[model samples]
Target: MALWALVSAVGLAVDDRVLVGAPIWAKPFKFFVSFAAYGLTLAWMLAQTTWGRRTGWWAGNVVVLTSLVEMVIITGQVIRGKRSHFNAETPFDASLYTVMGLTIVVLWAATLVIAALLLRTRLADRATAWAIRGGVLIALVGAGLGFLMAQPTAEQRAAGNLDTADVIGAHSVGVPDGGPAMALTGWSTTGGDLRIPHFVGMHALQLIPLFLIALVLLAPRIARLGDARVRLRLIRVATAGYAGLVALTTWQALRGQPLVHPDAPTLMAAGVLLPAVAAGVWAALRTAPEPESVRTKTEPASDSKEFTA
Candidate 1:
């Protein structure tokens, strides 16, 4: 996958063809990078499972296999100078799209199985445990959001293009696919782009774990974080906040609002969520009992030496 990303990067630089108003290699490049992260994260999560280890392993392999198949089809279509998703201009294109859909469905189910197995297993660190669990849970929802782009828009339906149109669905809601888009990402700037929420939601698996790691790195400098219980509470708060972010982004996209141009309602929703999350973190810190590590640090020299001895 990493090699594919490098190849795609070269293609992006050299390929002169444009499809849907973006570099033809762009989608394949992004997919290669995303699947790499997805596969690695799932493999690591499987290792953390105690019970149902075999099931998790199998599920992880399924993800790897399906991801490979999906990337192959996408890259193949790119080589042919054709659009990958929602392309039904010909019978072959339609069949390939259908296969891609089926593979993703299988991939999603495999991830769900892995998530269930992880939920059953207990980890030593509470923050790390929930980080894996919550990340996978929210990632599933994010992956599921891709289906929203599969359905034909109301315009397509009203225009009677379901049978005759070259493309049956779109990533953009109010704007056509080959319109003004954000650089690099190709997300529609004038309308809601489902890809925004989908990308953000799907990456929770990486984001949440990184959050815990960040908190741990800061623990020595922030006394309250020395308490495992306090860290766990903070993790819970962060996970909730992350979930809310996913929901908010999804809602914004569905309402046909561009991410950068969020209106009053979107801003208001964020306003409410920000303070709640801050309050949760503050309460967790304020209520935490002084950690044993802090007590040890403050102990008399003789007591510390005796404890070490």
Candidate 2:
């Protein structure tokens, strides 16, 4: 995935501009990089679970096939000098869009199956288990938001410019597609953009688990002070806070407001949430029992198992 992302970056550097004025390869590049991170993270989490060999292989095949199909159509459209998404300029373009959407549905279903498997399995590390479950559930909500993006806005229909084949919708709201955007993210600075939440929520699989791992490494004393159960609580609190941030960003975007221009209510909400999250983290860490390493070596085998897992 990292290699693919690097290749896409090279493509972006040389690709010509499209109708929207951005590099034609920008979308593909972004997807390549994003999916690389996403795929690698999911693979790591699955390895930690007790999925049977056959089930794992089936799931892996589904992920690879769907991702390749989606990327091929998207990159193919770019090369054809047409939009990959929300494009119905012709029957062929429409068909491509429909196929891409269906592929995503298959990918999402596979993800849900993996999530369920993780939840049902008895992971040896409670914190890691909680992280995987929370990340998958949050990421599913992110994927579900794509449905909202699939329905055309009233403005699009009112324009009377769309064709019968233009069944797919768009990512931008309160503004026409391909308007002004931020530097790298391309998130609109002038209108509400669903892509913000979609991106943040989709990457939770990487962010949550990585964050927990960082906590253990950087704050070893605190992490080791807690039993797996205590660490699980800490993870749950952090995940709740992360979910809240996703929701807040979605709400902010729905208001036709750019992320760079938060209103008073948005600020107030953040003010409240920030301290609450900090307090939760502090309490979770402070209340944990002393580190097991300080206990006798004759202690129960469960602690050793938890650490190893």
Candidate 3:
């Protein structure tokens, strides 16, 4: 992952030349960074599982191999001065695009299997288990968003673009491909970009697990609050809020609203949702049972094994 990050940095530094609507090295740099993050998160999650170690091992291999294939193809295309996604300009490009699509489908399937394994296994910490399960499921939804980008939009069809038939759809909803974008991310600032929710969803695996870790570190303090169930309830509340945020962002993007320039209705929706989510969390905490520490000298040993990296 560190090596990929360094490579991404190098790609960014030398991406002054433009190709196919953006910097020639932009796609490769983004893929490198994204793959690094995904690899680290996936590895951590697999390490936490006790059951299906063999399945997890195989699944991890699949993920790594497929991810490499994706990055190689994307980077190779950029080096060739061609669009990686939605490019069917030639027989070769179309074949490469097909292979990339199929590769992602396999990756998604492997992720589902990992999610199932996580669901069936019992972890030492229920909150951590819930975090992994919820994170994978939410991440799958984010992965599925790729399908939306894979289909040609009405606008694309109307434009009679040459690559319209061979290429999948695009990332930007209200703007043409390769338009003005945000600095580092290159997500469209002038219109809705499906990549926003997609990116957020992908990182749930990392974010939710980190949240679980924070809760675990604070377990001693939390136990003093007179509620053993507080930790579990907090996890549930956070999962709900996280899922809601993903849905909200997807909705916002579908409505052609840019992430940075949300309109009145979007703001109003968020206003209502924020309080509702807070109320849910408060209710969960308020109704939790008294802390076990208040009645007992020590907590019982957990049956599950500790997660190792």
Candidate 4:
């Protein structure tokens, strides 16, 4: 997957062909990069799971297989200079898109199986455990968001062009695809893009665990963070905050609001989320027991001397 991403990167540089207002290779490149991270993350998850190891392992393989099928279709479409998604210009294109859709659904189901198994497994590190569990659960929801884009756009439906349309669905809500978009990512800048929420939601498995790892790395420098309970509370807070972010973004996109142009309601929602998360963190720290080092250092002199003996 990573090698494919590198190949796509080269294609991006050399191929001047533009599709949907972006380089033809851009979508394949992004998908390949995402698949590389996703595959590695699932591998790690299977290794960490104990009770349902066999089930998880098989499910992980299913995920890999389905993902490969999806990618093959995508890369193949790029080679043909045809749109991989929502393209129904020809019978072959429609069939390929349908196959891609089926493979992605299978991939999603396999991920759900792995997530269920991960939920059942026990780990000693509460923070790490929650990170994995929360990440997978949120990622499941995030992955599911892609389905929102599968429906034909209102414009297509209103035009009675559902079956005959060259494009069926669209990532953009208020605007059409291939319009003004952000650089590299190609996300719509003029209107709500469902891809924004989908991207944010789908990567929680990577982002959440990375957040936990950052906390662990900071533990030595931050005394309260060294406490297991404190760390666990913080992780819980972070997971919830991340979930809220996904929800907010999803809501924003669905309402035809571009991410960068959130209206008052969006700002108000964010305002509430920010302070709630801050308060949660503050409470976590305040309620935490003293760190091991602090407790040991504050121990009575006599006890300390006896321990030295």
TM-score of each: 0.93, 0.88, 0.87, 0.93
lDDT of candidate 3 at residue 113, scale 0 to 100: 84
lDDT, model 2: 0.81
lDDT of 2 by residue, 1-309 (tens): 567668778878776576565777788889998888888887887787776645766786798799989998887887788888888878888889889889999999988888877788787778888888899899989888877788877687786666664545777778766888898888988888899999989988888998778766755565543455557668888899999999998998888888888999999989988898999887876665655575446666666667774
Output the better candidate (2/3) by TM-score: 2
Spell out the clash pairs found in candidate 2: none
Whole-model lDDT for model 4 versus the true structure?
0.90
Off by over 4 Å in 3: 160-167, 219-228, 287-309
Residue 160, candidate 3: how far off, in angstroms? 4.7
TM-score of model number 3: 0.87
lDDT of 1 by residue, 111-229 (tens): 99999998998999988999999999999999999999999987888899587788988898887888888887888888899998899999999999988888899989987777888
For each candidate, the alpha-carbon lDDT, in order, equals 0.90, 0.81, 0.81, 0.90
lDDT of 3 at 73: 88
Q: Considering summed lDDT, which 10 consecutive residues are worst modelled in model 1?
A: 290-299
Candidate order by decreasing TM-score: 4, 1, 2, 3
- Arrange candidates, best lDDT first: 4, 1, 2, 3
Q: After superposition, how far is residue 88 of candidate 4 from its true place, in Å?
A: 0.4
